[model samples]
Target chain A: MANTETALKDVMSSIDGAIGVALVDYNSGMALGTLGGSAELDLNVAAAGNTDVVRAKVRAIELLNLKEAIEDILISLNTQYHLIRPLTGRSGKGLFLYLALDRSRANLAMARHQLKRIEAELEV
Target chain B: MKRTLRQFTGRRPPVLIDPELLAGPGLLDELSGLRARVPHLTGSLVATTDGLVVAHDTRGLEPSGVAALTAAALGVGARLAEATGQGEFRELLTRGELGYTATYAAGSFVVLTLLAGPDANIGRLHLEARRAGRRIAELSDAVLARQDRD
Candidate 1:
C-alpha cells in the first residue's frame, strides 16, 4: 500500500491552489500525515479541527438512518475552500483527506475532480 | 484497562421525559407529520444527548444505536465550533451516495435528525427541518418544565 506521506504529497501538488493538506483520523482527531501548511495555518490543528466536522456528519447520517456512503464534504469560505474527502477504500476507512485551497486561485470543480481521483488512488 | 472499565461503567445522564406527554404517540406522530411535509424525507427521529431514542419515525433502523452515535458526534461538533470560535453548535448535514442526512440541535438536551432521498431540495429540507426542530424543542421543554412544576 502507498504510504500516507506519498498520498499527502500527491494531494498538495495535484490540486491547484492547495494551501495545505492532511490525512486525518476523525475518531481520534489526529493527522497521520500532513503537507503544505504555513505558520499561520497549521495542518495539524486543521486536521484535528476538521475531525469534528467529519464525525458530526457521520453521526447525523446514522441518526437519520440513511443507507449510503459519504462522497466528500465541501466547506466554502470567503477566501478559501475546505474540502474533506473521506477515504472509503478497504484500508482507508476512518481516514480522510483534508485539502485547503485559496478561493481565488483554485478552480472548485477541478479541485473536487482531482481530489476524487487522488482518493481512488490512495492506498491507505 | 482502566479506561475500558470506565467506559463500561460510565454514568449516563438521566433521560428527561414527561410520561404524560410520551404516554401517547404525540411526538412520534409529529415527527411523522414532518416527514409527510417534506416530500423527500425518508425518516426522522428525536433522541437524547446520551443517544437514547425518545421518538422516531425511521423504518428498518435501530433508534437507540443511532441516538448514541448522534450524541458522540454532537460532542465533537460542539467542541469543534467552540474551539474555532465558530459559535454554538446548530446543525450538521452529510451528503451521501444515496441521499442526505441532516441533524439539528433541537434544544439543550435533544437532537432532531432527518433522512432525505437524493432528489430532495436541500434548501427546502433545511427550511422545513429547522422549523420543525424548533417546534419540537419547545414542546419537549414545555413538557419537562410542567412536569417539574407538578
Candidate 2:
C-alpha cells in the first residue's frame, strides 16, 4: 500500500510529458491532493469544473435508462489530454485520479496503461 | 390508542407500503453484500433515477447530495453514449484533485456511486460496481413498484 504522496510522485515520474495530477472528489468538488500543475493550469478549478462534467454524465445515463459502467473519461484539448479514472477501492469511494498530459510528449495508450498500474498500487 | 389506530388505518399512511409480492427485504444488507464482494467500494448508495434516496453506507457524507449528483451524472453520460452510438449509458467516471467518483446504473430505479482514493484499482472498481449495480437495480425496481402502489 503506497501512501498518497508516494503514489503521486511515482505517477509523475512514470508518465512522460505529464503536466499535473490531482485526486478529486466529484461529490463535493474538493481536491484531496495535487501535483505538477502550473500557474496557467489551476488543478483545483479544473477538478471542480470536471465535477460538473461527471455529474452531467451520470444524470444523462439515468434519463436514458442505460445500464452500464464507465471505464474512463478522456478530455482532449488542443495541446493536452485530460484523463479521469475513478478509483474502486474500499477506502477511496467518491474520489478520482485526474492526469493531464502534453499531447506532444505523451502516448495515450502507454499513459492509460501506466495510470491503471499506478491506481492499483496506490494506497488510499 | 384510538388516535394511533386512526392514523395507521385511516386516509392511508404517508409512506409507501408494498405487498409481500412486491416488497423485498435486506436492502441495506444487499448494499453491504456488495461491499463484501468489492473490497474497494469505499462507499455505496442506492438512489432513484429521479434522485430519491433508497439506502446508503456513507460515512459522514450527505446521501441527498449523492443522489442528486448521481442523477446529474447519468444525464450527461446518456448523451455521450448516444452521441457516440453506444448502446446504453452504464457507468461514469469523474476525476478530481482529491479522488474519483464513479456512478453505475443500477437498473432504472437506482444508481450506485463509488468513492476511492488516488491509488484505488480502477478495473476492480468497474467490475464490482457493475455486479452491485445489477443487484441494486433489481432491488430498487421492487421498491419502486411498492412505492407506486402506495
Candidate 3:
C-alpha cells in the first residue's frame, strides 16, 4: 500500500520530463501533497484549478449523454502536458493524481501508461 | 435548451413552472425521510450539477452555498472516478472531526448531499442515502423529461 507522499515521490522520480506532481483533494479544492513545482507552475494552484476542468468534462459528458468514463483528462499546451488522473482505490475517492510534464521531453503515451500503474499502487 | 425546458405547465394562462416544481416536493420528502431514519442526521439537500438547489432539509447553514460547493465537489469526484478507471461515479463520503458529509450521484446532472453528526452510523448512512440518491435521480430525470414536454 503506497502512502500519498511516497506515491507522489514515485511519480516525480520515475515519470520523464515531470515538471511537477500533486495529490489533490477535489472535495475541498486543496492539495493533500505536492512536489516539484516551479515558480511558473504552482502545483497547488494547478491541482486546484484542474478540479474545474474535471468537473466541466463530467458535465459535458452528462449533457451529451455520452455514457463512458474518462480514463484521464489531458490538456496539451504549447510547452506542457497537464495530466489529470482520478484515483480508483477505495480510499482515493474524491481525489485525483495531477502531473505536469514538459512536452518536449515527455512521451505522452508512456506517461499515461505509467500514471495508470502508479494509480493502482496508490492506497489513497 | 435549458431555457426551453422551463415552460408553463397548466391550463389557459398557464403558470410558469420551476423545473423543480415537478419533483421538488418528492425530493424534499426523500431528504426529510432520510433524516428521520438516521439519527444525528444534521441536514440533507439535493442540487443540480450546476449548483442550483432542488430541495433541502438543512439548518443554520445556507442551502445555496452548500449546493454550489456540492457541485464543485461533484465535479472533482466524478473526474477522479473517471481517471481511476472506475466505470461511473457512485458516491463520495468525507469525514470531518465534527461530522460527516456524504454525496451520491442522483443522475448525470444531480447530486444528493447529506450531513450527519460524528456519532452517526456510517454504514446505515450509505445504505439509506444510496437509496435516496437513486430516487432523487428518478425524480429529477422525470422532471427534466416533463420540462422537455412542457
Assess every candidate by TM-score: 0.48, 0.45, 0.48
After superposition, the stretches of candidate 3 with alpha carbons farther than 4 Å from their true spots are A1-124, B1-19
Best by lDDT: 3
Please state the CAPRI-style docking class of candidate 1: incorrect
TM-score of 2: 0.45
Question: Which lDDT tens digits does candidate 1 get at residues B5-78?
Answer: 11111343344543335323667777878877666689888886666778888899887787788878777777
Q: What digit string (tens of lDDT, one per residue) describes model 1 on residues A1-124?
A: 4578877788788889999999987655567888998998988768756776777798899999999778999999989999999998998988899999999999999999998888888887
Residue A30 accuracy (lDDT) in model 3: 64
> Against the true two-chain complex, what DockQ does each candidate achieve?
0.02, 0.03, 0.02
Q: Tell me which residue pairs clash in candidate 1.
A: B51-B67, B51-B68
lDDT tens digits, residue span B4-85, model 3: 1111111111333353664456777898899888767899988766677878898899999998898677777766776787
Give the per-residue lDDT digits (tens) of candidate 2, residues B1-150.
001112211233344432233324566777677677544456777765556676777787998898888876776677677668775667789877767788887665456787876645455566567777777666656665556676
For each of the candidates, what fraction of the native contacts does it recover?
0.00, 0.00, 0.00
Ordering by lDDT: 3, 1, 2
Q: What docking tier does model 3 reach?
A: incorrect
